[model samples]
Structure formats: structure tokens, C-alpha cells
Target: MRIYISADMEGVTGLVDRDDVQPGGRDYERGRRMMALDVNAAVRGAVAAGASDVLVNDAHGPMRNLLPEDLHPAARLIRGRPKQMGMLEGLVAAHDAMICVGYHARAGALGVLSHSFMGHEIEDMWLDGRPVGETGLAQATAAAIGVPVVALTGDDVACAEATDWDPSITAVAVKYATDRFAAELRPEDDARQAIEDAVSAALAAPLAVPEPAAGPAVLEVRWQSASVPATLAGLPGVTATDSRTVRAEGELPALYRQFGVWMRVATALTNQPPYC
Candidate 1:
């Protein structure tokens, strides 16, 4: 089986703040190592369960959190910025299954470092008119490509959300979300075991994702600042909705293509220099 893994840093075991995932911070290096180790563990499980190929996507800040030398030798990595599909880039019809590793809930959720996409830059994001966090939105995009999201590892809230939206998928809930910056978390060994078990179960009885919302999808993002999408309108058809929400229309792929561009604009506007 070919597995596509989208690894995010926020939901890794022991992560609790932005400083952990940001470069040059006191804890970023240590946290990045942990993130890589977690991904390695999941790869171990997938390989043991008969997976022949695995592609890991470093889906975090700067998209360069994982060290190549430290990654599993059997795995291929999709690393870069401004990807065509962003979080779901390496995922395609060729992959047998997908594993969403180290993900968290939406911005306001009770999960460690939880946020939908751009965190504080984006207040909320929706797909086809329903509120969805990063996990849900990413999975929906994967669904469009005909690949099943076999396993997901994250905090309690993230797994819970996955349960309601995609119950057939395996879950490894490693932390109990206390708030965005804090969590009642399990030790690394325990979390690793949970992830391993979920991977095994997922491989044994891989479940198909529910049908994705068919074409002509609508995308909206409620930003922290209303001006975000106003700038996006300049990027083709992305338009502003009232003040907070930005609206766009198309099929899943087209809307996400447009959405990714808008997201870039928002990131540029919200980015702050070290002096700031």
C-alpha cells in the first residue's frame, strides 16, 4: 500500500504553544524532533502492516519542521511551500490510504495549539457552508481524490471531531485539550502506542471515506481582519462576504485552488517581522 501522511506539529505529543513550532524559539528544535519521532513511529506501524510506499508531508509552519536525516528511510517526503493543494498535495488517486498525523482542532477549540488554517489570522473556515477545522477540511479534500483517510492522531477534541465527521477512520487521541495553549497530555510512549495501534487497525480494515460534497463547492473563510479577502478579490474571483467572511465558488479542486491563493494573501497581510 502507498500511504500519504500529512504531518502537522501542533497536535504532536507535548506540544502546547506557538513557540514550540516556530523556528529560533527556545523549544522549536526539541518540538520538531518529537514531531519527527511521532511521524517515524507511524511509519513504522504502516510498514509493519504491509505498506510498501509512504510519502510524508511536512504540513506545518514554514513546512520545514522535520529533519530529513531523522526521517524513516522507507518514506518519501513532500516538503515545500505554496503547494497546489497545500496540506493535501501528495495525496492522489495512486495512494492506497492516508494517515493524518499530529493534527489539532479549529482555532477556538480546546486543543493544544488548535487552529483551522492560519490560526489567529483566520477566525474560522467552512466547506460547503459547514464549519470545519483543519482535520475535516483536509480530509474532505483527500476524499475528492478517492483516497481513504485511514488513521488520524491528535488531541481528544480533534479525534472527537473526526469521529462525528468520519467515524470509520481510525483515531489516536493523544491529549486532552484544556485550551488552545494547554492540554492534559499523555506521555510520548503512550501516545506512540496509540498511534501504532490505530495504524495497525486502519491497515487491517481500511475504511472508505464517506462521499465528499460533490462539485460546485462553496468556500468561505472568516478572518480575524475583514481586509484579508478584500485583497483576495484582487487574486481573481475571491470576494469579500460582509466584513469578516470571504467567499469563493467552484468545484472542490478549483475552490481550494482559489482558497489557497486567498490564504497566501491573508498570511502575507498578517505576517509580522521579528522587530514587530
Candidate 2:
């Protein structure tokens, strides 16, 4: 079996603030190590469960957070940005199963460092009338390529969201969220062990590819700033559904392509000088 893993920072054990994941944050180094450790654990778990090939995607900001020197030797890492599929870029039809490692909760959810795509730039997002966070959105992208998300690891809220999306998928919550920036964390060793064990168990069962949404998917993006929606509304096939909400309609792949572009734009706008 070939396993694909998408690893993010915010959901890693002992991480809770932006400073943890962002480059400027005081704890950024620690956070990156934790993220890499989680990925390594997943890689080990996948290998233990008979996965012959493991591909890990660095899905956090800068898209290069994982330290290659410290990563597991059995897994190849896909790092850096401008990826065609963003978070799910490394996933493809050739992979037998996927594992979403160290993911956080959706925007407004009670989880450590919880936020959707571009953090504060995006307030909410919906696909085909169902509200989804990073896990759900990434899963859809993987599903498009006939990959089933077999396991996920994160905080309590993220695990709950995963279970709600597909109960059969294995979920491991390394922390229990007390609020957005705080949680009762599991010890690093324990979290890693649990992640490895859970993944091994999940891969031992028969996995099924998830079905894609019906044709002409509609994506509703609610931005944190009215300017974002207004800017997107100017694009063809995109309209402002509300002051801070923009709507885009197209085929799944096309919509996902555009959505990646939008995320980049929003992220750029997020750090501009107030005068700009």
C-alpha cells in the first residue's frame, strides 16, 4: 500500500498559538519539530501496517515547515508551496490511503489554533451546502483522485469533525481544547504512540474511496474582511453573496483550482500595511 500524508502544524501536540506556527512566533521552532515528529510517527505507522511507499506533504504556511533531516527515512516529503492542489497536492490515484496528520479544527470551532484556510482571512467556507474545515476540504480533493482518507490526528474538535464526516476513519486527538489558544495536551511520546497505533489499525481494514459531490459544485467563501469578498466578486463566475461572503460555481477541479488562487490572494492581503 502507498500512503499519502498531509501534515499541518497547529494540531501538533503542545501547539496553541499563531506564534507557534508562524515564522515570527517565538515557539515556531518547537512547533515545527512537533509537526515533523507527528509526521514521522504517521510514516512509521503506515510502514508498520504494510505500506510500501509513504509520501508526506508539508501543508502548513510556507509549505516547508517539516525538517527533512529529521523526517523518517522511509517516507519522502513534498515541501514548498504553489502546489496544484494545496493541502492535498501529494495525494493521487496511486496512493492506497491518506492520513491527515496534525490538523486543527474549522474556523470558530473549539480547538487549539483553530482556523480555516487562511486563518483570519477566511471566516467560513461551504462546499455543496455543507460547511467544512480543512480536513473535509482536503478530503474532497483527495477523493477526486480516488484516495480514501484512512486516518486523521489533531485536537479533540478536529477528531470530532473527522468522525462526523466519516466515522469509519480513524481519529486521534492529541489534545483536548479548552479554547482557541489553549488545550490539555497529551505528552509528546504518548501522542506519537497513539497516532502510530491508530493509523496501523485503520490501515488494517478495507478502505473505500469516497464519492465525489454531484456536478457543478458551488463554493461559498466568507471572508473576514468585506474587501476580500468585494475583490473576489469582480472575478468572472464569482459574486458577492453578502458583505463578507463570495460565491463561486464550477466543476470540482476548476473550483478547487480557483480556490487555491483565492487563498494566496487573501494571505497576501492579510499582511499588507494598514494604509494599503
Candidate 3:
């Protein structure tokens, strides 16, 4: 079976903030290695479970966080960013199941380094009005391609959030959130073991790919500012709140993807870094 693994760095074990996730910081390299280790654990589990092909998409900043040499020799890696599918790159109709490793909740979520596609662009995203994080968006893409999200690993909040979106998947909570910025970490060995165990469970009992609510999907976003919503509303069918938000109702995956472009554009225009 073909399995797709989407990897992000924020929810990685032992990571706490921006420096660890960015390109030129002291903690970045070490944090990336930790992410690679977690991904390797997933690959090991996928191999053991008899998956014929495993694809790892490095979806973190610059989209090149995981080191290629450190990845499992057996798995193919998808790195770099700004692709047609975004974090869901390397996924296709042939993929039997999907796994989100090191995913955190969206910005404003009570999870470590929580942010959506971009720090402030996606204030929040709701599919059919149900709140979803980046993980949920990745799941939506998988669903669109008829693939189910079979496993996920992160701190407690992330796994908890997944239950609402993908209740049937395996969840491994290797850390516990102390707050949005900090967590109660597991010993390295335990965290690595837990990741592999969850992957094994996921492969043994894959969830049925549910219909990803063919929208009339309404994505209501509350950005950190108001100006961009004004710019985003210029897109057809996109609506702007009086001041601080943008809402796009009556949209489907295709249109939502376009709508997401507006969100990113606005975020880039408004980005001030250091959270303001």
C-alpha cells in the first residue's frame, strides 16, 4: 500500500518556539533532527506494516526542515514549499492512507507553536463550519483524494483536536501542553517508541475515508489585522468582515484553495514578525 506522511516541525518533541522552526537560528538544526527522528520512526512502522511505498513531505518553513540523509533510506522525501498541493504535496489517488507527523493546532489554538498555513493568515479555518487546524486542512486534501488520515502524533492537544476531525485514526500524544508555548516532554526514547507504536496501530486498522463534506464550506477567518480582509474580499465570492476578519462561504476545495491564496497574500502584506 502507498502511504503519505506529512511532516511539520512545530509539534516535534523538545521544540518550544520560533527559533527552533526558522532557518537561521541556533535551535533550528537540532530541532530539525528531532523532527527527522520522529519521521524515521513512522517510516520504520510503515515498513513493518507492509506498506510498499512511503512518501515524506517536509511541510515546515522553507519546506526543507528534515535532513534527507537522516530520513529512512527506504522512504522517498518531498521537500521545499509553495507547491500546488502545499503541505499535502506528494499525495495522490494512489495513496492508500495519510499520516500527519509533528502537526500542531492552528494559530490561536491552545497547542505548542500553533499556527495555520501561515502564522497570521489563517486565523482559523472551519470546514462546513467545523473548526479545523492545518492538520485538518491536510486531512481535507487527503479526503479529496479518497485517502484517510490513519495516524497522527504530537502533544496532547493535537491528538485531541484530531479526534474531532479524524476520530478513527490512531493518536499518539508524546507530550502534554503546559500552555500554547510550552509542553511537558517525554523522554527521547519514549517519544520515539510512542510514534512507532501509533503508526503500527494506524496501519493495522485504517479508517474508512469519509466524504470530505462537499462544501458549501464556509471558512471564517479572524486575522490579526483588518486591511487584508479588504484586499481578500476582492476575490469572487469572498467576503470581508466589517473590520478584522474574512469569510468565504459557499466554497469548495478548489475555490477554497484560491481563497487561501488571498489569505496568504494578506498575511505576507501584514507580516511584522515576532507576533507584532
lDDT by residue for model 2 (1-276), tens: 999999988889888888888887799998898898889999889989999999999998888899899899999999997898888876778899999999988887878888887766677899888898898877776777788888999999999998897777789999999988889989999999999999999898898877877677888989878777777777898889889998888876667889988877776666632101
Highest lDDT against the true fold, candidate = 2
Quote the positional error of residue 159 for candidate 3 in Å. 0.9
Residue pairs with clashing backbones, model 3: 107-115
Predicted candidate 3 versus true structure: per-residue lDDT over 43-112, tens digit per residue = 9888888889999999877788887899999899988857666777778878888888998876777888
Better of 1 and 2 by lDDT: 2
Root mean square deviation (Cα) for candidate 2: 2.4
Candidate 2 has its poorest 10 consecutive residues by lDDT at: 267-276
Off by over 4 Å in 3: 249-252, 274-276
Mind giving the per-residue lDDT tens digits that candidate 1 earns over 1-276? 888899998889888877787898799999999999899989988998888999999998788888899899989988878687788876778888889999988767766777777767777877788888888777777777778787888888888888777877788888888877788879899899878777977887845554767667778888877678667766666677777787787776556666777777777887732211
| Model 3 lDDT, full chain set | 0.79
Lowest lDDT 10-mer window, candidate 3?
251-260
**Against the unseen true structure, what C-alpha lDDT does each candidate score?**
0.81, 0.85, 0.79
Taking the candidates one at a time, how many backbone clashes does each contain?
0, 0, 1
lDDT of 2 at 227: 76
